[model samples]
Target: MSTEIELPPGDQSLLLVDDDKAFLTRLERAMQKRGFSVRSADTVADGLAAVEADPPAYAVVDLRLEDGNGLDIVSALHSRRPDARAVVLTGYGNIATAVTAVKLGAVDYLSKPADADDVINALLATGEAPPAPPDNPMSADRVRWEHIQRVYELCERNVSETARRLNMHRRTLQRILAKRAPR
Candidate 1:
């Protein structure tokens, strides 16, 4: 059986699953800015608890958490709150996990250093389902890359803050974004 929700008119309540406290706080504030009510957790267990206790209308999950794979968290969300939408964000973007995320019922997948807006867009974009790509390539690559860059710039290239929000590391983010930067 499915639970009914009063569709959020402007912004919806959201569940944020990640292991970084500072980043989680920043994200929660950003979501609140967009009129969202955010309930946060630093591990899969905490996420499951929040969902079981007071389910949110949506979830913004990182593919990797300090304790375990965020996929497990997504699965729990689906099983407990089937109506809730999910968007998986990752720092180690790869094809296998990306496919698995969709298979597990995520609405979209994203790379790290992601902006709150792109995350929100993936959460709230309610029309024209994206084509089933054999592999979700870098089609959203340029736009996503650009968005992340601006965020990095805004954070003054502070790798810790950027990585925390993007769920990545100082080195990894530097390396990846370097590849995307213009020559």
Candidate 2:
């Protein structure tokens, strides 16, 4: 028993940009079910082209695409359509990147695996009131682990590079990576 989300009255055109084909397809179908006319792009170039061809009223863009960063798309969308609402989705979420996304005109920054409901709420939120706290926020250990994992991934899984970038001992990072994620 879930309450239906009421979209703000306007164009329902939406652009979905993500390198993950399966996730993109899933989100596309879900948004369509909720009445958005969805168009999708799997690369930064394609996303930019789509935005240029037709600016969408709403956009859900992944932070890291195979070809380039998704912020490019967000920036282009904002430039083309200042009234558009956009959300930045990422697997490697951090405070700095979230701030940058907001500054670049994203209405919200959501971590990956966000459901259709969460995305819809973000797209429609008026920002007049603060959002409620998460029911089960990640623990400090979990947050640290996630950050380390993100760095490791960004460093292309090179232990030395990740350790140097994080300023952490190689052994420490290796041990942390070896262990299972904290609750």
Model 1 CA lDDT for position 48: 76
Instruction: Please list the C-alpha lDDT of all candidates, in the order they appear.
Output: 0.77, 0.91
Q: Please give the TM-score that candidate 2 achieves against the real structure.
A: 0.78
lDDT of 1 by residue, 71-168 (tens): 98788778887877899987778899999998887888987656676677678667677632232334576656766775686578886788788887
Who wins the TM-score comparison?
Answer: 2
Q: Per model, how many backbone clashes are there?
A: 0, 0
Lowest lDDT 10-mer window, candidate 1?
Answer: 1-10
Model 1 scores what on Cα lDDT?
0.77
After superposition, which runs of candidate 2 have C-alpha atoms over 4 Å from their true positions?
Answer: 1-3, 91-103, 111-113
lDDT by residue (34-141, candidate 2, tens digit) is 889999999999999999999999999999999999999999999999999999999888999999999999999998767787788889888999765554666888
